[model samples]
Target: MSAEHLDDIGARLAAARARVAAAEHDAHRAPGSARLLLATKTVPLDGVRSALLADAAARAGDPAAPAPVLVGENRVQELVAKAPHLADLAPEVHLIGPLQSNKVNQALGVAGCVETVDSVALAERLATRCAASGRVLDVLVQVNVSGEETKHGAHPDAAVRTALDVAALDGLRLRGFMTVGARSSDPARVRAGYRLLREIRDEVRDSGEPGAEGAIELSMGMSGDLELAVAEGATIVRVGSAVFGARPL
Candidate 1:
């Protein structure tokens, strides 16, 4: 890797950290209440490892750095390919892309959490596979708050019901809800999408559904709108380009 490339990555991570800090401060959230998940899709394994190393070094002096969490990947193949090479790092990997039924086992092989579960069928498959392995899988129901036909998430109106059903399944833990913001520069539009997810999260928490009453995570926001997401009560932010520069073509 070129020194310039790594430097670019470092600069991006520093900027991302600054944004997270500023957002947390503005929200009056306790330090580290929100966490950043470095999105690694399309970024090479070496790049991923370098980013983690940089992330660790950046917070080495700060005892209050955010809690340990997984790096997010959009493809199962990427997770499976890079997982062993990055094993010593012990990075928790979360699948943030839409998951197909055929890929459930492959995803479970590496990911600790599935943040883009859009349907009950996919959730049940994940639960069954986890049950067979005698392990529980953490998951977030993805809601299409943007209502864009291109998005892969349950509609907001149907999200609660879907979440309730997913929560009832065995061997799967419903951690919270996740959504992608509108693909616009407008902060108001982006905030609206995140706010919808938070609203759904609040409703699910009080819905008496199993696994819903506990601390439900809101995994919204991305490289572009994470600040807005934090202001809207996002617990986990999936940041990509901002931290890794643009993905390799």
Candidate 2:
């Protein structure tokens, strides 16, 4: 990448971080409470590397910057392909897309966490794979709060039950709940969906069930709705275009 391109990536990352920090403050949440997860869906390897380098440079220059950088991939193939190349940067990678049962082994090979485990069957598959490999994988229950047929997640009503079942799995650690907010022009509608996820998260945490103790994170929102998500108690926001300047067509 050219120096100008690298500078552009750095600027975009800095802007995204600022947006996250500002959102946290506006919501009266502690600084750095809501972490940003760079969604590298179609980004090329150089672009991803540039973003990581920029993030690292920003944190090194400012000790008070938000927490360490996190990168999320929407495809197992992408994760498998890029993770090895980016291993030297030590980016905390999470599989944020729908994972197939057959691909569990490959997904676990690279992703340290799976954020879209939406079903007990899928959770079981992950657990079986983890058991054989002796690896404990972090997971979040993806809830379709919007009831969007196109979205991949457990229905909002079944989220708690799904979370409980996932928690019982031996090789998985229930980290929290994740949801893609309702796609609507009304911010209230979007915020309502995020708030519901938080409510479900609280219910699970309050249940005192085994493995529910650590299920406190709420990963919601994207570049557009991050403020709403943060206001609704999101601990992590997955951002793409806002940081990467739109994916390639």
Candidate 3:
């Protein structure tokens, strides 16, 4: 609620937007072609609101500014807690964290989209819940391009098969792929992961699998490697720390 805190968030959001804009231009993407899904994992609800307000204010003056349409959370608990109250901002709340079959109902209750769908079982669970609710949910299949054991996604080789499977589910709209780059200081390594994601997305799109028509989005990158991701044809970057400052320890 502090004015100073809100100002800090506004400034941070403005800077993040500038970086995304610059990256988009260098990548030769059309204006407003990409978006920054503020990864509001540990960020407070007020911080998210302030960032959206700042974006709205900027767009009110310049219509070309990148519109912030999504705010991502890592857990269903936080999403359910904040999504209803922040409906005014109109941003699609997404689950960017690992989703368990048991949490599908809770996640579907609040999330407009689930970006970290890593398994067929989870996808089917979501499809069932959506069917009961009479709603179709947008979902991005997560791929572990880095092959990290700790990451939650299908292996790179299995990504297309997984996406095709998920697409066939009636209640889930297959929206492309998402991945986490290797945690490394070498930019080349990170870019490789993003590149792999784009390649996979293209393969799936070309396969003409049942519901792969609109699987063009590549939800890659973060604060540390966003530019590299953009250079690799990322359509959406999940930036958090840069926009909201470091998370609380």
Best by lDDT: 2
Question: lDDT of each structure?
Answer: 0.87, 0.91, 0.87
Worst 10 residues of 1 by lDDT: 61-70
Model 3: per-residue Cα lDDT over 1-249, one tens digit each: 467877888788778778888988998877766788989887788888998888788778765556665789998889889987798878878899998777888888888889998889889988988998899999999999988788888998888899999999999999999998898899988999999999999998888788998898999999988899989998888888887778889
Give the Å shift of residue 154 in candidate 2: 0.4
TM-score per candidate: 0.95, 0.97, 0.96
Our tally of clashes for model 1 stands at 1
Where does candidate 3 stray beyond 4 Å? none
- Across 124-145, the per-residue lDDT of candidate 2 in tens digits comes to 9999989988989999999999
Clashing pairs in 1: 70-92
Model 1, runs deviating above 4 Å: none
**What local lDDT does model 2 show for residue 10?**
85
Candidates in order: C-alpha RMSD to true structure: 1.4, 1.1, 1.3
Q: How close is candidate 2 to the true structure, as a TM-score?
A: 0.97
Lowest summed-lDDT stretch of 10 residues in model 3? Answer: 61-70
